[model samples]
Target: MSYSNNAVKVFTVDPLNWQPWVETVDVKALTPAQIDVLSEAPGGLEKIGPYYALLAHDPEVLRERTRLFNAVMYGRGGLPRRERELASVAGSRVNGCTYCASVHGRIYNDLTKRTDVIQRIFTEGVDAQLEPRERAVVDFSVALTRSPERVTADDLQPLRDAGLSEAEILDLIHVVAMFAWANRLLQTLGHPTRDEVVLV
Candidate 1:
């Protein structure tokens, strides 16, 4: 399904405008009691801003998961910030998540100042016009996201050859994997993209 121009606008605004044809759950507008129920559920709603109220019900577990995800993305992971963003964009592209593709494409463009590269990755494929290292990262991300069962030592060797350490390679894999999960969730839940919001 194609995204409407206003679909993204919903995420840009505080109060979401639910579409008439789209039957979606508005996590942002839940009542206090509804928030409590979400907090008690498996995927704590607290990670997303609209669901923050759920923290009142179960702060500890939600906090721990958020912390670990943050650490993996920003702390101990040796993968460079730009590379991580590239991996995220690549995975989101393969998953057909326009929202995530736009978000991470903007990030990659801002950091690398390579709009051409971003355009190619989005319009063409991840393997379109990347350097060896960038190509390795994109290839690895696509492989891990699309067909993890097919991944082997040979699949990882190129990333190693591209100068990424084992830890950094694993970090890249984690970022790709996480985004795969995130892309599915956001797409399934009909989360809209706010690409015009300059995150940089």
Candidate 2:
């Protein structure tokens, strides 16, 4: 299907798929380097999709991007995995990146069993009511995503008060900041497709 950002409705927490605006590299025609990059990507070669295929056009860039994303979101011990996912969801929501939000929201739900939180976010938005810690996380993510330059150390106080340590707070910043770039890339390069809304 053709890609268009406007095609995917907002507030959809269901798992979604992307469609690239430009032609994607054919898996069969991939160079050895491109194949190597996809092999190391999150889901590996078997899982590479249109987004990965499109990025495969520049194997070096895609390799670095994939590594950075994996390190930040899937690396060990800085921020709790759930919190990292939460920051991602919050940032995606604020940026209106419905596909990103949906993907990460599913992960958050799996981690926390709090489908209610994702439900509230999708239905009510970034300002939706949340438990204190979640509220702090979502608030900070929103502020950073909305305007990074305006954020100050003071802006970090809420997260600190919510009991996050310096390391966790730093991790939060990294995740949210990464999403700001990720969301934009997803929106600018393609959009969520409506044809297949996988509920998994």
Candidate 3:
């Protein structure tokens, strides 16, 4: 597979598979704590994939991480879910995390029914052509992912100008920041492949 960030590749809305580089915890041998943590995670027990299993090595960390993840992504109010998904896609795209991008791209497409935008982003880069509002979200997410230190009040103007409220902008920032962390964990722990990947 091409590792280059700019290389054009097909991105599908369908679930992509991922595999862990390290040995993941065996589901059958899971401890009560690990099972509890995994149960609270996105897919719950039956869907505890290799990634979650690996993290389950430390049930406490995984528990806290799962709680925060669920709250951030599934929380009520503030930014609309679709824009949050868009920000995630932008961050993953910038980080070169194909798996994260594909997953979030699928969510974004499901929410907005705009597969073309995700297709363009995967084919192009974060600078892919998009609507004004989407452009603002993508640009901010890319900037934050590429260089968080360089982002400033000026950087947020575009979001505000695009009609986002302060709360929504804050939500956008949180989503981008979360993806920055999430993408790193995923890419560093494993690699995306078409082989026997644990489908989420």
Candidate 4:
């Protein structure tokens, strides 16, 4: 229940039951650059968890990353938040990034209140049987993540057909690509807790 970003508590099961398995950088020993970078963390990095401190090793990149991430994920327009979260889930799943999938799935559920698609994602793939619009977004996300080289402008036809405007299409692409990179970063930087454990 402690909230200090500088403490060195044993990384245990998160109350949310989705803790990062890797050790984060000690928040207290953070350099000035990292401090400055994290000071401007979007959505309050501390509230988001310890991963921001870890990524703060490269304050410049982390700043741009967080800035862009906040704008894309929490922006005013473009794909609906639910669809954006779905794209994150799709990209994370295709990239084999369990942490991103879990977190985004939770957001997807919270926003959409629909577990059927989440279950579909788990049992099948992002391209599982879905409503037409959902299927289009998932397909775009998966294809973009798995084989970016093979993807073409034509690949976005389904989303367009689903009534996504050009701006929404671009936003969806950015969200998917962002998760593709973010998922790889998370997988390489830290593992995630597999079970719930929150005694503290």
Among these predictions, the greatest TM-score belongs to 2
Ranking by TM-score: 2, 3, 4, 1
Runs in model 3 deviating more than 4 A are 1-14, 197-200
Q: Residue by residue across 1-200, what tens digits does model 1's lDDT show?
A: 34455465211112232222233235667656556555554456654332233233344554555555566567743999889888988898888766667767777778888787777886677669888999999999999989999999999999989999988987998898779766775576454543332111
Please give each candidate's TM-score.
Answer: 0.69, 0.92, 0.90, 0.81
Top candidate when judged by lDDT against the true structure? 2
lDDT of 3 at 107: 85
- Would you list the clashing residue pairs of candidate 2? none
Model 2, which residues run further than 4 Å from truth?
1-6, 196-200
Candidate 1 overall Cα lDDT vs. reference?
0.67
lDDT of 3 by residue, 43-69 (tens): 889887778878998999888877777
- Compute the lDDT of residue 36 as modeled in candidate 2: 92
Supply candidate 3's per-residue lDDT for 86.
90
Q: Name the TM-score of candidate 2.
A: 0.92
- Sequence-dependent TM-score of model 4: 0.81
lDDT head-to-head 2 vs 4, winner:
2
